[model samples]
Target: MRQDEVEIIEREICYQGFYRLERLRLRHRLFAGGMGPPIVREVIEKGDVAAVLLYDPLRDEVVMIEQFRIGARDDARGPWLLEIVAGLIEAGETPAQVARREALEEAGCTVLDLLPISSFYTSPAKTSQRTHLFLGRVDSANAGGIHGLADEGEDIRVVRLPAAEALLLAQQGKTDSAWPLLALFWFAGQREAVRARWSLAGEAPPASA
Candidate 1:
Protein backbone atom coordinates (compact mmCIF):
# COMPACT_ATOMS: atom_id res chain seq x y z
CA MET A 1 0.00 0.00 0.00
CA ARG A 2 1.05 3.61 -0.49
CA GLN A 3 0.85 6.65 1.74
CA ASP A 4 -2.05 7.90 -0.33
CA GLU A 5 -3.98 4.77 0.56
CA VAL A 6 -4.41 6.05 4.11
CA GLU A 7 -6.14 9.25 5.23
CA ILE A 8 -5.83 10.91 8.59
CA ILE A 9 -9.03 12.57 9.75
CA GLU A 10 -7.66 14.12 12.89
CA ARG A 11 -4.90 13.72 15.47
CA GLU A 12 -4.68 15.03 19.00
CA ILE A 13 -2.18 14.72 21.77
CA CYS A 14 -3.88 12.95 24.66
CA TYR A 15 -1.01 13.12 27.08
CA GLN A 16 2.47 14.61 27.23
CA GLY A 17 5.07 14.00 29.89
CA PHE A 18 7.91 11.51 30.04
CA TYR A 19 6.08 9.78 27.19
CA ARG A 20 3.55 11.16 24.76
CA LEU A 21 0.23 9.61 23.75
CA GLU A 22 -1.51 10.61 20.57
CA ARG A 23 -5.02 9.72 19.47
CA LEU A 24 -5.51 9.44 15.75
CA ARG A 25 -8.68 9.08 13.72
CA LEU A 26 -8.02 7.71 10.29
CA ARG A 27 -9.15 5.39 7.51
CA HIS A 28 -7.20 3.20 5.20
CA ARG A 29 -7.68 1.24 2.02
CA LEU A 30 -9.04 -2.24 2.63
CA PHE A 31 -7.51 -5.38 1.18
CA ALA A 32 -10.62 -6.38 -0.73
CA GLY A 33 -10.82 -2.85 -2.15
CA GLY A 34 -12.14 0.59 -1.24
CA MET A 35 -11.51 2.65 1.87
CA GLY A 36 -12.44 1.22 5.26
CA PRO A 37 -14.44 2.96 7.94
CA PRO A 38 -12.59 5.54 9.99
CA ILE A 39 -11.14 4.09 13.17
CA VAL A 40 -9.72 5.71 16.28
CA ARG A 41 -6.45 4.49 17.72
CA GLU A 42 -4.21 5.68 20.50
CA VAL A 43 -0.49 5.37 19.95
CA ILE A 44 2.29 5.89 22.42
CA GLU A 45 4.96 8.13 20.95
CA LYS A 46 8.19 6.76 22.34
CA GLY A 47 10.40 8.11 19.59
CA ASP A 48 12.99 5.85 17.98
CA VAL A 49 15.62 3.86 19.86
CA ALA A 50 19.07 2.44 19.19
CA ALA A 51 20.24 -0.71 20.97
CA VAL A 52 23.44 -2.72 20.91
CA LEU A 53 24.47 -6.17 22.02
CA LEU A 54 28.03 -5.80 23.28
CA TYR A 55 30.31 -8.73 22.60
CA ASP A 56 33.97 -9.31 23.43
CA PRO A 57 35.29 -11.80 20.91
CA LEU A 58 38.59 -12.35 22.70
CA ARG A 59 36.89 -13.31 25.95
CA ASP A 60 33.78 -14.85 24.32
CA GLU A 61 31.54 -12.86 26.60
CA VAL A 62 28.61 -10.49 26.29
CA VAL A 63 27.99 -7.37 28.38
CA MET A 64 24.41 -6.80 29.47
CA ILE A 65 22.61 -4.63 31.97
CA GLU A 66 19.96 -5.14 34.62
CA GLN A 67 17.67 -2.33 35.62
CA PHE A 68 14.20 -1.73 36.99
CA ARG A 69 11.57 -1.26 34.32
CA ILE A 70 8.23 0.09 35.35
CA GLY A 71 6.44 -1.66 32.51
CA ALA A 72 7.62 -5.02 33.79
CA ARG A 73 7.04 -4.27 37.43
CA ASP A 74 4.31 -6.88 37.64
CA ASP A 75 6.16 -9.54 35.71
CA ALA A 76 6.84 -12.70 37.65
CA ARG A 77 10.47 -12.46 36.62
CA GLY A 78 10.56 -9.19 38.57
CA PRO A 79 10.98 -5.53 37.63
CA TRP A 80 14.74 -5.66 37.25
CA LEU A 81 15.07 -6.86 33.67
CA LEU A 82 18.14 -7.82 31.74
CA GLU A 83 18.62 -5.72 28.61
CA ILE A 84 21.20 -4.62 26.09
CA VAL A 85 22.60 -1.09 25.91
CA ALA A 86 19.97 1.24 24.50
CA GLY A 87 18.77 4.80 24.48
CA LEU A 88 16.57 7.24 22.58
CA ILE A 89 17.94 8.73 19.37
CA GLU A 90 17.98 12.36 20.42
CA ALA A 91 18.08 15.19 17.91
CA GLY A 92 21.22 15.34 15.76
CA GLU A 93 22.16 11.80 16.82
CA THR A 94 22.38 8.78 14.51
CA PRO A 95 21.43 5.30 15.63
CA ALA A 96 25.09 4.32 15.70
CA GLN A 97 25.90 7.30 17.90
CA VAL A 98 23.17 6.36 20.36
CA ALA A 99 24.41 2.80 20.47
CA ARG A 100 27.97 3.81 21.25
CA ARG A 101 27.04 6.55 23.70
CA GLU A 102 24.64 4.29 25.56
CA ALA A 103 27.25 1.58 25.78
CA LEU A 104 29.64 3.82 27.71
CA GLU A 105 26.96 5.48 29.83
CA GLU A 106 25.06 2.33 30.69
CA ALA A 107 27.68 -0.42 30.47
CA GLY A 108 31.01 1.33 31.01
CA CYS A 109 32.45 -0.02 27.79
CA THR A 110 33.35 1.83 24.62
CA VAL A 111 32.25 0.14 21.43
CA LEU A 112 35.36 -0.52 19.38
CA ASP A 113 33.37 -1.33 16.27
CA LEU A 114 29.78 -1.81 15.25
CA LEU A 115 27.94 -4.25 12.98
CA PRO A 116 24.48 -3.31 11.94
CA ILE A 117 22.03 -6.05 12.88
CA SER A 118 18.47 -4.96 12.12
CA SER A 119 15.88 -2.24 12.34
CA PHE A 120 12.38 -2.99 13.57
CA TYR A 121 9.19 -1.51 14.82
CA THR A 122 8.97 -2.25 18.50
CA SER A 123 5.14 -2.46 18.61
CA PRO A 124 3.52 -1.17 15.47
CA ALA A 125 0.00 -1.85 16.67
CA LYS A 126 0.24 0.16 19.85
CA THR A 127 3.14 2.55 19.40
CA SER A 128 5.14 4.44 16.81
CA GLN A 129 8.44 3.43 18.36
CA ARG A 130 11.12 1.77 16.24
CA THR A 131 14.49 0.30 17.16
CA HIS A 132 17.79 0.04 15.31
CA LEU A 133 19.79 -2.90 16.66
CA PHE A 134 23.51 -3.54 16.32
CA LEU A 135 26.24 -5.92 17.38
CA GLY A 136 29.02 -3.88 19.02
CA ARG A 137 32.56 -5.12 19.49
CA VAL A 138 34.01 -4.31 22.89
CA ASP A 139 36.76 -5.35 25.30
CA SER A 140 34.85 -6.68 28.28
CA ALA A 141 37.90 -6.85 30.54
CA ASN A 142 36.65 -3.83 32.51
CA ALA A 143 32.92 -3.98 31.79
CA GLY A 144 31.25 -4.33 35.18
CA GLY A 145 29.93 -1.66 37.55
CA ILE A 146 26.74 0.17 38.55
CA HIS A 147 25.96 2.68 35.80
CA GLY A 148 23.22 5.06 34.66
CA LEU A 149 22.28 8.65 35.56
CA ALA A 150 21.11 9.01 39.11
CA ASP A 151 18.83 11.91 38.27
CA GLU A 152 17.01 9.60 35.89
CA GLY A 153 16.27 7.21 38.75
CA GLU A 154 18.37 4.58 37.02
CA ASP A 155 20.28 2.04 39.11
CA ILE A 156 21.70 -0.22 36.47
CA ARG A 157 23.88 -3.21 37.28
CA VAL A 158 26.31 -4.44 34.66
CA VAL A 159 26.11 -8.15 33.90
CA ARG A 160 28.66 -10.02 31.86
CA LEU A 161 28.00 -13.57 30.69
CA PRO A 162 29.49 -15.99 28.23
CA ALA A 163 28.00 -15.56 24.78
CA ALA A 164 26.75 -19.15 24.80
CA GLU A 165 25.11 -18.72 28.17
CA ALA A 166 23.45 -15.53 27.06
CA LEU A 167 22.10 -17.34 24.03
CA LEU A 168 20.78 -20.03 26.32
CA LEU A 169 18.89 -17.42 28.33
CA ALA A 170 17.21 -16.32 25.13
CA GLN A 171 16.39 -19.88 24.04
CA GLN A 172 15.03 -20.74 27.48
CA GLY A 173 12.98 -17.52 27.61
CA LYS A 174 14.72 -16.22 30.71
CA THR A 175 15.50 -12.79 29.34
CA ASP A 176 12.11 -11.45 28.28
CA SER A 177 13.02 -8.17 26.57
CA ALA A 178 12.58 -8.05 22.81
CA TRP A 179 15.92 -6.31 22.08
CA PRO A 180 18.15 -8.87 23.78
CA LEU A 181 16.14 -11.82 22.52
CA LEU A 182 16.32 -10.65 18.92
CA ALA A 183 20.02 -9.76 19.07
CA LEU A 184 21.03 -13.03 20.77
CA PHE A 185 19.03 -15.16 18.33
CA TRP A 186 20.70 -13.39 15.43
CA PHE A 187 24.11 -13.74 17.07
CA ALA A 188 23.55 -17.46 17.57
CA GLY A 189 23.69 -17.83 13.79
CA GLN A 190 26.39 -15.22 13.06
CA ARG A 191 28.71 -15.48 16.02
CA GLU A 192 31.61 -17.08 14.22
CA ALA A 193 31.48 -14.75 11.24
CA VAL A 194 31.21 -11.66 13.42
CA ARG A 195 34.04 -12.74 15.65
CA ALA A 196 36.27 -13.34 12.66
CA ARG A 197 35.38 -10.07 10.97
CA TRP A 198 35.80 -7.96 14.09
CA SER A 199 39.04 -9.64 15.05
CA LEU A 200 40.56 -8.73 11.69
CA ALA A 201 39.38 -5.15 11.89
CA GLY A 202 41.25 -4.53 15.12
CA GLU A 203 40.54 -1.27 16.95
CA ALA A 204 38.43 0.48 14.36
CA PRO A 205 37.42 4.03 15.26
CA PRO A 206 34.40 4.37 17.54
CA ALA A 207 31.16 5.90 16.30
CA SER A 208 31.56 9.65 15.80
CA ALA A 209 30.39 11.80 18.67
Candidate 2:
Protein backbone atom coordinates (compact mmCIF):
# COMPACT_ATOMS: atom_id res chain seq x y z
CA MET A 1 0.00 0.00 0.00
CA ARG A 2 1.02 3.61 -0.47
CA GLN A 3 1.81 6.18 2.23
CA ASP A 4 -1.71 7.51 1.99
CA GLU A 5 -2.98 4.18 3.17
CA VAL A 6 -1.56 4.83 6.63
CA GLU A 7 -3.70 7.10 8.78
CA ILE A 8 -2.20 8.90 11.69
CA ILE A 9 -4.66 9.15 14.56
CA GLU A 10 -2.53 11.11 16.98
CA ARG A 11 1.04 12.36 17.48
CA GLU A 12 2.59 14.12 20.45
CA ILE A 13 5.91 14.89 21.98
CA CYS A 14 6.50 12.45 24.79
CA TYR A 15 9.87 13.86 25.79
CA GLN A 16 12.24 16.58 24.65
CA GLY A 17 15.89 17.16 25.45
CA PHE A 18 19.08 16.66 23.47
CA TYR A 19 16.83 14.44 21.37
CA ARG A 20 13.04 14.17 21.05
CA LEU A 21 10.71 11.28 21.64
CA GLU A 22 7.40 11.36 19.77
CA ARG A 23 4.49 9.05 20.37
CA LEU A 24 2.46 8.04 17.37
CA ARG A 25 -0.86 6.27 17.05
CA LEU A 26 -1.69 5.09 13.57
CA ARG A 27 -2.99 2.31 11.39
CA HIS A 28 -2.47 1.21 7.83
CA ARG A 29 -3.92 -1.03 5.16
CA LEU A 30 -3.47 -4.75 5.65
CA PHE A 31 -2.73 -7.45 3.10
CA ALA A 32 -6.43 -8.22 2.94
CA GLY A 33 -7.13 -4.72 1.63
CA GLY A 34 -8.65 -3.58 4.93
CA MET A 35 -7.51 -1.17 7.63
CA GLY A 36 -5.50 -2.74 10.43
CA PRO A 37 -5.96 -2.00 14.11
CA PRO A 38 -4.34 1.14 15.42
CA ILE A 39 -0.91 0.72 16.94
CA VAL A 40 1.01 3.00 19.26
CA ARG A 41 4.73 3.58 18.93
CA GLU A 42 7.32 6.05 20.08
CA VAL A 43 10.05 7.36 17.79
CA ILE A 44 13.20 9.22 18.59
CA GLU A 45 13.52 12.44 16.65
CA LYS A 46 17.21 12.85 16.16
CA GLY A 47 17.68 14.98 13.09
CA ASP A 48 19.86 13.66 10.28
CA VAL A 49 23.56 13.19 10.78
CA ALA A 50 26.59 13.16 8.46
CA ALA A 51 29.41 10.63 8.84
CA VAL A 52 32.75 10.39 7.05
CA LEU A 53 35.23 7.55 6.81
CA LEU A 54 38.58 9.26 6.50
CA TYR A 55 41.11 7.65 4.15
CA ASP A 56 44.58 8.90 3.34
CA PRO A 57 45.77 7.68 -0.02
CA LEU A 58 49.32 8.87 0.63
CA ARG A 59 49.64 6.70 3.74
CA ASP A 60 47.02 4.06 2.91
CA GLU A 61 45.66 4.75 6.37
CA VAL A 62 42.24 5.15 7.90
CA VAL A 63 41.38 7.79 10.51
CA MET A 64 39.03 6.71 13.24
CA ILE A 65 38.06 7.70 16.75
CA GLU A 66 37.20 5.96 20.02
CA GLN A 67 34.72 7.65 22.29
CA PHE A 68 32.38 6.75 25.10
CA ARG A 69 28.85 6.15 23.88
CA ILE A 70 26.13 6.01 26.48
CA GLY A 71 23.95 3.92 24.23
CA ALA A 72 26.54 1.16 24.29
CA ARG A 73 27.00 1.24 28.05
CA ASP A 74 25.67 -2.27 28.45
CA ASP A 75 27.51 -3.84 25.55
CA ALA A 76 29.59 -6.86 26.46
CA ARG A 77 32.61 -5.01 25.09
CA GLY A 78 31.95 -1.82 27.04
CA PRO A 79 30.89 1.62 25.90
CA TRP A 80 34.03 3.04 24.33
CA LEU A 81 33.12 2.50 20.69
CA LEU A 82 35.30 2.75 17.62
CA GLU A 83 33.85 4.94 14.92
CA ILE A 84 34.74 7.36 12.17
CA VAL A 85 34.36 11.15 12.24
CA ALA A 86 30.74 12.16 12.44
CA GLY A 87 28.45 14.95 13.63
CA LEU A 88 24.85 15.98 13.60
CA ILE A 89 23.83 18.31 10.78
CA GLU A 90 23.29 21.73 12.31
CA ALA A 91 21.00 24.45 11.11
CA GLY A 92 21.96 26.01 7.77
CA GLU A 93 24.66 23.39 7.17
CA THR A 94 24.76 20.84 4.38
CA PRO A 95 25.78 17.24 4.72
CA ALA A 96 29.17 17.89 3.12
CA GLN A 97 29.72 20.84 5.45
CA VAL A 98 28.97 18.68 8.46
CA ALA A 99 31.36 16.01 7.18
CA ARG A 100 34.17 18.53 6.80
CA ARG A 101 33.52 20.12 10.18
CA GLU A 102 33.42 16.73 11.91
CA ALA A 103 36.70 15.70 10.34
CA LEU A 104 38.43 18.74 11.74
CA GLU A 105 36.79 18.58 15.15
CA GLU A 106 36.95 14.85 15.71
CA ALA A 107 40.13 13.86 13.81
CA GLY A 108 42.02 17.13 13.37
CA CYS A 109 42.29 16.61 9.61
CA THR A 110 41.34 18.78 6.70
CA VAL A 111 39.36 16.81 4.17
CA LEU A 112 40.64 17.36 0.66
CA ASP A 113 38.41 15.10 -1.36
CA LEU A 114 35.02 13.68 -0.50
CA LEU A 115 33.04 10.91 -2.19
CA PRO A 116 29.44 10.20 -1.46
CA ILE A 117 28.90 6.62 -0.39
CA SER A 118 25.30 6.27 0.74
CA SER A 119 22.51 7.42 3.05
CA PHE A 120 20.61 5.21 5.43
CA TYR A 121 18.17 5.35 8.31
CA THR A 122 19.74 4.20 11.56
CA SER A 123 16.59 2.44 12.82
CA PRO A 124 13.42 3.21 10.97
CA ALA A 125 11.31 1.21 13.41
CA LYS A 126 12.44 3.28 16.39
CA THR A 127 13.78 6.59 15.19
CA SER A 128 13.70 9.13 12.41
CA GLN A 129 17.48 9.35 12.26
CA ARG A 130 19.14 9.18 8.87
CA THR A 131 22.87 9.34 8.25
CA HIS A 132 24.65 10.52 5.13
CA LEU A 133 27.91 8.66 4.64
CA PHE A 134 30.99 9.80 2.74
CA LEU A 135 34.53 8.74 1.88
CA GLY A 136 36.96 11.59 2.58
CA ARG A 137 40.58 11.82 1.47
CA VAL A 138 42.81 13.42 4.05
CA ASP A 139 46.41 13.75 5.22
CA SER A 140 46.68 11.26 8.05
CA ALA A 141 50.32 12.11 8.78
CA ASN A 142 49.24 14.01 11.91
CA ALA A 143 45.74 12.67 12.47
CA GLY A 144 46.14 10.95 15.80
CA GLY A 145 45.48 12.91 19.00
CA ILE A 146 42.69 13.71 21.43
CA HIS A 147 40.04 15.98 19.93
CA GLY A 148 36.52 17.05 20.83
CA LEU A 149 34.44 19.97 21.99
CA ALA A 150 35.10 20.64 25.63
CA ASP A 151 31.61 21.83 26.36
CA GLU A 152 29.98 18.83 24.74
CA GLY A 153 31.53 16.41 27.25
CA GLU A 154 33.23 14.63 24.40
CA ASP A 155 36.48 12.77 24.99
CA ILE A 156 37.44 11.32 21.64
CA ARG A 157 40.75 9.61 20.92
CA VAL A 158 41.88 9.69 17.36
CA VAL A 159 43.18 6.45 15.90
CA ARG A 160 45.05 6.05 12.63
CA LEU A 161 45.69 2.60 11.25
CA PRO A 162 46.37 0.88 7.96
CA ALA A 163 43.26 0.82 5.80
CA ALA A 164 43.52 -2.92 5.34
CA GLU A 165 43.80 -3.49 9.08
CA ALA A 166 40.92 -1.19 9.85
CA LEU A 167 38.78 -2.87 7.25
CA LEU A 168 39.72 -6.25 8.68
CA LEU A 169 38.71 -5.11 12.15
CA ALA A 170 35.42 -3.84 10.81
CA GLN A 171 34.84 -7.12 9.01
CA GLN A 172 35.61 -8.95 12.25
CA GLY A 173 32.90 -7.03 14.09
CA LYS A 174 35.23 -4.84 16.10
CA THR A 175 32.87 -1.93 15.61
CA ASP A 176 29.42 -2.51 17.09
CA SER A 177 27.84 0.33 15.14
CA ALA A 178 26.51 0.29 11.61
CA TRP A 179 27.75 3.56 10.03
CA PRO A 180 31.48 2.93 10.39
CA LEU A 181 31.17 -0.70 9.35
CA LEU A 182 29.18 0.27 6.31
CA ALA A 183 31.76 2.89 5.40
CA LEU A 184 34.60 0.38 5.63
CA PHE A 185 32.85 -2.19 3.46
CA TRP A 186 32.09 0.48 0.89
CA PHE A 187 35.70 1.65 0.89
CA ALA A 188 36.99 -1.90 0.55
CA GLY A 189 35.09 -2.24 -2.70
CA GLN A 190 36.05 1.15 -4.17
CA ARG A 191 39.55 1.65 -2.78
CA GLU A 192 41.62 1.07 -5.89
CA ALA A 193 39.37 2.90 -8.30
CA VAL A 194 38.98 5.84 -5.98
CA ARG A 195 42.70 6.03 -5.29
CA ALA A 196 43.40 6.10 -9.00
CA ARG A 197 40.86 8.82 -9.57
CA TRP A 198 42.24 11.01 -6.76
CA SER A 199 45.80 10.66 -8.07
CA LEU A 200 45.06 12.73 -11.15
CA ALA A 201 47.13 15.73 -9.93
CA GLY A 202 44.50 18.14 -8.67
CA GLU A 203 44.73 20.24 -5.53
CA ALA A 204 41.10 19.56 -4.59
CA PRO A 205 39.49 16.13 -4.85
CA PRO A 206 36.71 15.79 -7.36
CA ALA A 207 33.10 16.01 -6.31
CA SER A 208 31.13 12.88 -5.55
CA ALA A 209 31.03 10.65 -8.67
Candidate 3:
Protein backbone atom coordinates (compact mmCIF):
# COMPACT_ATOMS: atom_id res chain seq x y z
CA MET A 1 0.00 0.00 0.00
CA ARG A 2 2.88 2.34 0.76
CA GLN A 3 6.63 2.48 1.23
CA ASP A 4 6.25 1.57 4.88
CA GLU A 5 4.31 -1.56 4.01
CA VAL A 6 6.92 -3.08 1.73
CA GLU A 7 9.97 -4.57 3.46
CA ILE A 8 13.27 -5.12 1.71
CA ILE A 9 14.78 -8.14 3.43
CA GLU A 10 18.04 -8.74 1.56
CA ARG A 11 19.69 -7.50 -1.61
CA GLU A 12 22.86 -8.46 -3.44
CA ILE A 13 24.50 -7.59 -6.68
CA CYS A 14 24.11 -10.57 -9.00
CA TYR A 15 25.86 -8.86 -11.87
CA GLN A 16 27.31 -5.51 -12.83
CA GLY A 17 28.26 -4.07 -16.18
CA PHE A 18 27.19 -0.73 -17.62
CA TYR A 19 24.25 -1.19 -15.22
CA ARG A 20 23.56 -3.47 -12.26
CA LEU A 21 21.31 -6.43 -11.56
CA GLU A 22 20.24 -6.96 -7.97
CA ARG A 23 18.65 -10.07 -6.57
CA LEU A 24 16.46 -9.42 -3.58
CA ARG A 25 14.45 -11.48 -1.15
CA LEU A 26 11.47 -9.61 0.27
CA ARG A 27 7.92 -9.73 1.56
CA HIS A 28 5.16 -7.19 1.97
CA ARG A 29 2.08 -6.70 4.12
CA LEU A 30 -0.99 -8.01 2.32
CA PHE A 31 -4.07 -5.84 2.02
CA ALA A 32 -6.27 -8.66 3.25
CA GLY A 33 -4.29 -9.49 6.34
CA GLY A 34 -0.67 -9.80 7.53
CA MET A 35 2.66 -10.15 5.70
CA GLY A 36 2.77 -12.41 2.66
CA PRO A 37 5.30 -15.17 1.96
CA PRO A 38 8.86 -14.20 1.22
CA ILE A 39 9.57 -13.86 -2.47
CA VAL A 40 12.66 -13.54 -4.63
CA ARG A 41 12.84 -10.80 -7.20
CA GLU A 42 15.54 -9.53 -9.50
CA VAL A 43 15.75 -5.81 -10.10
CA ILE A 44 17.67 -3.81 -12.66
CA GLU A 45 19.46 -0.90 -11.04
CA LYS A 46 20.50 1.40 -13.83
CA GLY A 47 20.23 4.45 -11.66
CA ASP A 48 17.78 7.26 -12.51
CA VAL A 49 17.35 8.88 -15.90
CA ALA A 50 16.38 12.37 -17.12
CA ALA A 51 14.39 12.69 -20.33
CA VAL A 52 13.51 15.87 -22.17
CA LEU A 53 11.33 16.77 -25.13
CA LEU A 54 13.17 19.40 -27.13
CA TYR A 55 10.52 21.87 -28.29
CA ASP A 56 11.17 24.79 -30.56
CA PRO A 57 8.22 26.94 -29.53
CA LEU A 58 8.64 29.39 -32.43
CA ARG A 59 8.73 26.73 -35.13
CA ASP A 60 6.08 24.62 -33.41
CA GLU A 61 8.36 21.61 -33.85
CA VAL A 62 9.98 18.93 -31.71
CA VAL A 63 13.54 17.58 -31.87
CA MET A 64 13.77 13.81 -31.50
CA ILE A 65 16.53 11.19 -31.58
CA GLU A 66 16.79 7.80 -33.22
CA GLN A 67 19.07 5.06 -31.96
CA PHE A 68 19.36 1.30 -31.75
CA ARG A 69 17.72 -0.25 -28.69
CA ILE A 70 18.83 -3.76 -27.84
CA GLY A 71 15.69 -4.44 -25.84
CA ALA A 72 13.54 -3.98 -28.90
CA ARG A 73 15.47 -6.44 -31.04
CA ASP A 74 12.66 -9.00 -30.90
CA ASP A 75 9.99 -6.57 -32.06
CA ALA A 76 9.02 -7.01 -35.69
CA ARG A 77 9.21 -3.25 -36.13
CA GLY A 78 12.96 -3.35 -35.42
CA PRO A 79 15.11 -2.03 -32.58
CA TRP A 80 15.94 1.41 -33.89
CA LEU A 81 13.83 3.58 -31.63
CA LEU A 82 12.67 7.12 -31.97
CA GLU A 83 12.70 8.89 -28.64
CA ILE A 84 13.30 12.11 -26.72
CA VAL A 85 16.76 13.04 -25.48
CA ALA A 86 17.71 11.27 -22.25
CA GLY A 87 20.62 10.08 -20.13
CA LEU A 88 21.44 8.63 -16.75
CA ILE A 89 21.89 10.89 -13.73
CA GLU A 90 25.53 10.71 -12.75
CA ALA A 91 27.04 11.33 -9.36
CA GLY A 92 26.90 14.99 -8.26
CA GLU A 93 24.55 15.81 -11.15
CA THR A 94 21.03 17.20 -10.92
CA PRO A 95 18.17 16.06 -13.12
CA ALA A 96 18.33 19.38 -14.98
CA GLN A 97 22.02 18.93 -15.61
CA VAL A 98 21.47 15.46 -17.04
CA ALA A 99 18.69 16.79 -19.24
CA ARG A 100 20.83 19.56 -20.68
CA ARG A 101 23.79 17.28 -21.22
CA GLU A 102 21.75 14.59 -22.94
CA ALA A 103 20.12 17.18 -25.19
CA LEU A 104 23.41 18.44 -26.52
CA GLU A 105 24.99 15.00 -26.77
CA GLU A 106 22.06 13.29 -28.38
CA ALA A 107 20.28 16.02 -30.30
CA GLY A 108 23.00 18.63 -30.66
CA CYS A 109 20.80 21.37 -29.20
CA THR A 110 21.13 23.44 -26.06
CA VAL A 111 18.20 23.84 -23.74
CA LEU A 112 17.25 27.49 -23.15
CA ASP A 113 14.50 26.76 -20.63
CA LEU A 114 13.26 23.57 -19.04
CA LEU A 115 9.68 22.89 -17.99
CA PRO A 116 9.29 19.95 -15.66
CA ILE A 117 6.83 17.42 -17.01
CA SER A 118 6.89 14.54 -14.52
CA SER A 119 8.87 11.87 -12.73
CA PHE A 120 7.99 8.17 -12.74
CA TYR A 121 9.38 4.66 -12.53
CA THR A 122 10.38 3.20 -15.87
CA SER A 123 9.43 -0.35 -14.88
CA PRO A 124 8.32 -0.43 -11.28
CA ALA A 125 8.05 -4.21 -11.13
CA LYS A 126 11.44 -4.97 -12.63
CA THR A 127 13.70 -1.95 -12.30
CA SER A 128 14.62 0.66 -9.73
CA GLN A 129 15.06 3.21 -12.51
CA ARG A 130 13.03 6.38 -12.21
CA THR A 131 12.92 9.00 -14.94
CA HIS A 132 12.44 12.75 -14.62
CA LEU A 133 10.85 14.23 -17.72
CA PHE A 134 10.88 17.81 -19.01
CA LEU A 135 9.77 19.96 -21.91
CA GLY A 136 12.87 21.87 -23.02
CA ARG A 137 12.79 25.06 -25.04
CA VAL A 138 15.46 25.23 -27.73
CA ASP A 139 16.48 26.59 -31.13
CA SER A 140 16.27 23.47 -33.32
CA ALA A 141 17.63 24.94 -36.54
CA ASN A 142 20.98 23.13 -36.30
CA ALA A 143 19.74 20.25 -34.19
CA GLY A 144 19.68 17.66 -36.93
CA GLY A 145 22.96 15.74 -37.35
CA ILE A 146 24.82 12.63 -36.26
CA HIS A 147 25.70 13.00 -32.60
CA GLY A 148 26.63 11.08 -29.44
CA LEU A 149 30.05 10.31 -27.98
CA ALA A 150 31.87 7.85 -30.21
CA ASP A 151 33.96 6.51 -27.38
CA GLU A 152 30.78 5.37 -25.69
CA GLY A 153 29.79 3.42 -28.81
CA GLU A 154 26.98 5.82 -29.62
CA ASP A 155 25.69 6.54 -33.11
CA ILE A 156 22.60 8.69 -32.89
CA ARG A 157 20.56 10.54 -35.48
CA VAL A 158 18.68 13.71 -34.66
CA VAL A 159 15.19 14.23 -36.01
CA ARG A 160 12.92 17.25 -36.24
CA LEU A 161 9.20 17.08 -36.86
CA PRO A 162 6.08 19.09 -36.27
CA ALA A 163 4.83 18.62 -32.73
CA ALA A 164 1.45 17.44 -33.97
CA GLU A 165 3.04 14.83 -36.19
CA ALA A 166 5.17 13.58 -33.33
CA LEU A 167 2.09 13.18 -31.14
CA LEU A 168 0.35 11.33 -33.92
CA LEU A 169 3.32 8.93 -33.96
CA ALA A 170 2.87 8.34 -30.25
CA GLN A 171 -0.84 7.74 -30.68
CA GLN A 172 0.00 5.15 -33.31
CA GLY A 173 2.78 3.61 -31.23
CA LYS A 174 5.41 4.64 -33.71
CA THR A 175 7.69 6.30 -31.19
CA ASP A 176 7.59 3.07 -29.07
CA SER A 177 8.62 4.63 -25.80
CA ALA A 178 6.86 5.96 -22.70
CA TRP A 179 8.71 9.18 -21.79
CA PRO A 180 8.45 10.70 -25.25
CA LEU A 181 4.78 9.78 -25.54
CA LEU A 182 4.04 11.16 -22.10
CA ALA A 183 5.86 14.41 -22.92
CA LEU A 184 4.05 14.78 -26.24
CA PHE A 185 0.61 14.37 -24.66
CA TRP A 186 1.50 16.72 -21.84
CA PHE A 187 2.75 19.30 -24.32
CA ALA A 188 -0.45 18.89 -26.32
CA GLY A 189 -2.66 19.94 -23.40
CA GLN A 190 -0.32 22.80 -22.40
CA ARG A 191 0.64 23.97 -25.90
CA GLU A 192 -1.60 26.99 -26.19
CA ALA A 193 -0.43 28.44 -22.89
CA VAL A 194 3.26 27.80 -23.64
CA ARG A 195 3.01 29.22 -27.14
CA ALA A 196 1.13 32.27 -25.88
CA ARG A 197 3.79 32.98 -23.32
CA TRP A 198 6.60 32.53 -25.85
CA SER A 199 4.72 34.65 -28.44
CA LEU A 200 4.61 37.60 -26.07
CA ALA A 201 8.36 37.29 -25.60
CA GLY A 202 8.63 37.02 -29.40
CA GLU A 203 11.41 34.45 -29.36
CA ALA A 204 11.25 32.18 -32.40
CA PRO A 205 14.55 30.96 -33.82
CA PRO A 206 15.37 30.44 -37.48
CA ALA A 207 13.13 27.69 -38.93
CA SER A 208 13.84 24.22 -37.57
CA ALA A 209 15.74 21.83 -39.86
Identify the candidate with maximal lDDT. Answer: 1
Model 1 residue runs over 4 Å out of place are 200-209
lDDT of 3 by residue, 1-209 (tens): 88888889998999999989999999999989899999999988899999999988888889999999898999898998999999999999999999999998898899999989999999999998999999999987777989999999999999999877888898887877888888998988998677666553555533433
Highest-scoring model, TM-score = 1
Per-model TM-score on C-alpha atoms: 0.94, 0.92, 0.92
Winner on lDDT (2 vs 3) = 2
Per-residue alpha-carbon lDDT of candidate 2 for residues 1-209, written as tens digits (9 for 90 to 100): 79999999999998999999999999999998899999999999989999999998766788999999999999989999999899999989999999999999989999998999999998899998899999999988888889999999989999998888998898888877888999999899998787777664765433332
Residue 54 alpha-carbon offset, candidate 1, angstroms: 0.2
Winner by TM-score between candidate 3 and candidate 1? 1
| Alpha carbon RMSD to native, model 3 | 2.5
TM-score of 1: 0.94
lDDT by residue (1-209, candidate 1, tens digit) is: 99999999999999999899999999999999999999999999979999999999877789999999989989987899999999999999999999999999999999999999999999999997899999999999988989998898889999999888899889999999999999999999998777767764555423311
Clashing pairs in model 2, backbone N/Cα/C closer than 3 A = none
What is the Cα-based TM-score of model 2?
A: 0.92
